[model samples]
Target: MTRLAMMLSAVALLSGCAGRGGDLPLQPASALGRERATPVDATYQLGVGDQIALAVYGEPDLTRTYAINPNGTIEVPLAGTIKAQGMTIDAVSALIRDRLADGYLRNPSVTGSIVTYRPFYILGEVNKPGQYPYQTGMTLEGAVALAGGYTYRAQKNHVFIRPETGGGETKVEATPEMAVRPGDTIRFAERFF
Candidate 1:
């Protein structure tokens, strides 16, 4: 079979295994799953501490790239200061366009993209412990893979994730195909008698 076919078969088999463990409630399927999805607002949102690039056609003097400040704002020429945090890059561009069109420029077109994603944390029993950069579509297995693939003492079954959500830690049973997030603390406990 081709690699793609082999992968699909493997995924089918693994999903079957994920279903058998029933200890944890299955989260509704996320867009992060095996299939790629298109969103109505597809651009990534700029958060506090995000680095962004901005461009203006025929107005290079007013264009610049910078990291969003702690207050989630950026100051630009003519536009002064604008809040950019919690907004998608495209939305930021549109906001700039609106300001420029209000007598700053004729039909200004603005564009922004995330140059860096803030780092998050992962810890416990993983081969490598500490902070890792945030990446979309990250999962438990994928995070473990990045951590040098579980230490010999790493428990294959009980994995814990403490996310940055600021609520509480989540303990989960690990399936090889399970997903994880950056800024999440993943702990593998030892099996006991």
Candidate 2:
């Protein structure tokens, strides 16, 4: 009876341990995704490879698109070259208006918008991960899908993104609604089950 009791107790202990500790807790990097805060949308910063469209009121000749030069400037007719990198659309419009007002046109009304954004990068644990063209209202989930979806062992809920505007990488829980910006690098880590 004592031997049977001992065997039953051993089996109970083993089963309890198995139920309690199936996998080791994820390390700091992996654990980071769970405690996500609401992500704020930062203003879009212009960079090289971005295509911008600008138009001036009643100036058909000046209404066109131009790719940002490697030096962060764009050529404008009669206005010469104007710096555009790191400036918002409104700021660019103001700059153009000021430039055109000089010996060109009085109170030149200008409007500018981004035609194309720089490509985003994705690597690690995703199938066919690489650079992909960025679209408006992109999210982490969307980026993963563009990269051909997650791999078999991808941590679908955990992701890290590095912004091109200069901040370091951030780890956040993957959500379909979180907005992604151009020139961001996304990483879908592997999961250990």
Candidate 3:
């Protein structure tokens, strides 16, 4: 379909976007057409593609950092290996703290932050449509920019957000302020004019 047509048609699909993780909070990056946006739990689950930064208070020896393995685990000094998938960031922090307190270190404090959210896909009408990482609070316009902006044939009037539910309920007036969820499929259509 033409860029304008794709945009116009896709805008009508936002109302139907859904994701796969039934219990997981739906980030804009998650695939669509199955579930609604889920809330982030107090703890963060370590995923395969997730990047993390770890720190310990006053203990560089015990405070090392690493990304979770493709299998959803990480390697540490004393802790050996730990599975982080499905565990909240807080949960991971506490585990580290306890491990350190248990002879690994003296009254160690552990903390971790998610450094990467992984890649989400965008197709149809974007200049470089494909997979892009999910940055916190990123907007539709920013996503488009990452994809190399709209094509000359892009329909500037309406952009559709397909959430994997196979369609959407979003209006034609979606703006840049709208949060770009993970796994969201944005489509730009051709203008009638």
Candidate 4:
């Protein structure tokens, strides 16, 4: 009886540690699919660590690549400091145009494009987990491949991701097509069996 009780207790303790800890809110995989399907409708917002290339028509001095500062702002040659975080590329371009028109030039035409996006991180149960450069249209499965795939004990059905946009980690089903955003931290949980 003593030996059986000990075995049962050990089994219970092991079962409790099988899953990833913490109460992460669950987001259905379909929701992620829907978000990716309509990428044109939702524009990508700029954030810190992103590099942007801006060009001002007929003004070579004001055209250059600028990195978004930690405070979510970027300093342009004639535009001074402008907030780029949470703003779209077109919005930033318009702001620069307006800023230049304020005192610098007449109807200054400005265009902005993303030079480089922030990196994404991966951890837990993957063969090689670390930060990797983000590419446009990257998916969860693609990220897993970059992380050297999953370990034998990894739970392949779902994973947890904390978005860079500032929100609680959400549990999403691990699918080949699930979109991955820049600066996201993805975690793969261990499997019990």
Candidate 5:
């Protein structure tokens, strides 16, 4: 009876170990696809290391491309420094217009666009994992392609991503159309088999 009880206890422990208790929850591939399908606040927020082109109508001197400084501000001639971080393109344009309207221009018609996006990082289980230039509408598959595709032992089903906006790392099933955002860190998981 004692031996049978010990065997049952060992079996129970083994069963508990077999259960996925510590693994990160992974979002289904279709879930990511559905997320991509839904249009949520599609505005792109500016951040440090992003290059922006600002144009002021009828004012050639004030129209130029500017890089967001490390301090998250951009210095405009005559208008001084304006905060651009975490602001949308239109918001930044409006702010610049307001600043220039303050004795700088009669009616500052300003428009802004992103010239270049910040780079994204990829690591683990890829052939060449490192920072790569971010392009608009880039997908995770494209990012993997940029990283020279996955390694032989890479887990092709899912990957972990840490967004640039700051959040806990998410485990998401790998899909071809998953969007990749600027400054995101993507980590490919290795296969256990």
Candidate 6:
């Protein structure tokens, strides 16, 4: 019985050393600044590849949908090129309004909203790991599902997420309800039996 107890204690110690189901190297969320923090607010900031539906009140000519260019700018009629990436919907609308007010219209009521969010990336230990279009209220488990679910060798307990806005990667305990933001990169580690 004493020998069995010692073996069990060793196993417990080893498991603790391996971390909560073998966590990989990743930065903590606390290390990120507010500018690079994950989006938990109501409005998601725009990014490249995001489709935006913009409207100009009473100006059908200016109402249309635009995909944010890779360089983070959009081409608006009369406004020429306006930067939209990293900006919220209201900010982009105001920009359009101001540009139209610049001798184009008496008062332009511009409104904009995200038609589709940019894609998120998933890598490591998955059946199909690659970039997938982001959906609202997506979670880490859903992302894994999009990537064809976890492989038999997947760790399955935690994941590493790197924010696209230039913050350090963070390792988080994996759960189906954990919210995922756009432009995030997820990496699933391999399980060690």
> Which is the leading candidate under TM-score?
4
Clashes of each: 6, 0, 46, 0, 0, 1
Maximum-lDDT candidate = 4
Model 6, 1-193: lDDT tens digits are 9999999999998876674545445443333332132444546688898899999999898899999999999999998898998888889999989989999999889988788888999999999999998887777777888999889999887778788888766776676667677888888877776
TM-score of each: 0.65, 0.74, 0.60, 0.86, 0.83, 0.79
Task: Estimate every model's Cα lDDT from 0 to 1.
Answer: 0.67, 0.77, 0.66, 0.85, 0.84, 0.81
Worst window of 10 by summed lDDT in candidate 6: 28-37
Residues 34-81, model 5: lDDT tens digits: 234222233889889899999999999999999998999999998889
Give the least accurate 10-residue stretch of model 5, judged by summed lDDT.
Answer: 33-42
TM-score of 3: 0.60
Model 1: clashing residue pairs? 120-183, 121-183, 139-179, 139-180, 140-179, 140-180
lDDT of 2 by residue, 95-187 (tens): 889889988998889998888888889999999989999887776667878888888998877567777877766766677666666787887
Flag regions of model 1 displaced more than 4 Å: 1-44, 162-166, 181-193
Clash number for candidate 1: 6
Q: Candidate 4 at 166: error in angstroms?
A: 1.8
Of the candidates numbered 2 and 4, which has the greater TM-score value?
A: 4
Better of 2 and 4 by lDDT: 4
Model 3: lDDT of residue 85: 72
Off by over 4 Å in 2: 1-42
**Of the candidates numbered 1 and 3, which has the greater TM-score value?**
1
Which residues of candidate 3, in runs, are more than 4 Å off?
Answer: 1-45, 152-173, 182-193
Rank the models by lDDT, top first. 4, 5, 6, 2, 1, 3
Model 4 misplaced stretches (Cα beyond 4 Å)? 1-26, 33-42
